[model samples]
Target: MAEHNTSEERADDMQTQQAIAVEGLTKIYGTGESRVAALAGVSFAIDAGEWVAIVGPSGSGKSTLLNLLGLLDRPTAGRYALAGRDVAGLRGAELARTRGELIGFVFQSFNLLPRETARTNVELPLVYAGVPGAERRRRALEALDRVGLADRAGHRPPQLSGGQQQRVAIARALVGRPTMLLADEPTGNLDSATGADILDLFAELNAGGVTLVVVTHDSTVAARAGRVIEIRDGRSYERDTVRATPAQVAAPRQLQGVLS
Candidate 1:
């Protein structure tokens, strides 16, 4: 009986693990008449290396879920775990450390420091993580090179074009080598061509085993993900998974030369 119980416990523990997992997650604001439920109850699990997209119209609670997933805000109820560790109630330095260590962020605005060079901006996360100066610079440059922005290392945000600035932001996000990458409307500010290039880059990264969670209203962006989750009225519903054609299956290798 004792051995059987131990085996059952192990099996249950194994089932809860993933890159991201949430059960009955809810976030509420205000009280009574003014109360609003940003997320009523969302439960989902994203496996490691899976590319998932969250899509919804405005005010659908997608943004609220993103904030919760990124650990910028706590849920009012239920559970959230990243890499199988519960994080629904993390706060203060613990929260900051977990977020910094496990997640990378890319934004639509290309949030870079106007006065700082590309390499400097890319090194910011490592600095906050207490990496030494010499190692930080090397890692930052490597990340920029991965995104095809190595030659622009000395350029400031204002000095670069929009696509270039966004690349720099991607490099910055990659510098820390976080367990997951969270992007919010990453292509919102770019032209169609440029945005397509970025999307291809994201696909390549996902192919290379990076876990991605993107929140967007753009159908094109949502289509790029392997799985889509729709948020409506603070609830979540899983859409059909995107099946890849033969050519699409072979496309990741070809994506390497896209930015080049």
Candidate 2:
């Protein structure tokens, strides 16, 4: 009994520090005859520094869950606690501020500004957050360095290769040192080799204690994460049955070998 009570106490403490928590989360579109439920009573918690992957086929609630987690959309009926603060009801400027302060986003499309230098692109978030110019520049350069794009910081998006541009996007996402990194199909556009490299970068970031939540349809990508949450028909389930191919499991080992 004592051990069970201790375990329960530990779980409560862990939840208190959770980077993202959702309970009974639901999103519905339209109404009556045209109603569509994107997410139906989803519940989960992602702890700080853990690597999680959300995987599903087309029409699943993967994107819908990502939107809610990123604070881009509100749930119809649920509780969402980001970094221990309930934010399910926050809207407008409050929502934007919370998102900017606690969450960093990386999209499959390298959404870099076409005419801006990589450094300038990375500085945009800091600019919005009201960081001073000199400080923003310093942080942007540091973020670029973290993603191994410091040498290309002066180059515009069109001048960089696809992989390089994605790295710049990642740098931009990390510039503010957000509490959680939310990536949606991050490697969807890259070639196999380049995607592998990006996955390695993600592993490195996770190793350094970044809380990462990746939304992808690729089983290989999901295999690399520490935990996999499979969403189907607007509901989430923790995947315990192995869905990874032998090659998929071996890929991360190969990456680890290279890193070593």
Reference-based lDDT, each prediction? 0.80, 0.81
Clashing pairs in 1: none
Residue pairs whose backbone atoms clash in candidate 2 = none
Error of 2 at 102 (Å): 1.5
Per-model TM values vs. the true structure = 0.79, 0.81
In model 1, state the lDDT of residue 19: 78
lDDT of 1 at 35: 98
Cα error, residue 172 of model 1, in Å, equals 1.6
For 1-260, candidate 1 gives per-residue lDDT tens digits of: 33656865655544433678777789999999999999988877777789999987888898789888888778898777787777755778888889889899887577799999999999999999999999999999998987778899999999998878888888888889887999877777677887888788889888878899998878999999999988877877777532321111111222222211
Per residue, candidate 2 scores C-alpha lDDT tens digits across 1-260 of 33666876765666555777677788998999999999888877778898999987888888788888888787888767787777756888888898898888987677789999999999999998999999999999999987778899999999998878888888888888887899988887677776787788789888887899999877788889999988878877778753442111211221222212
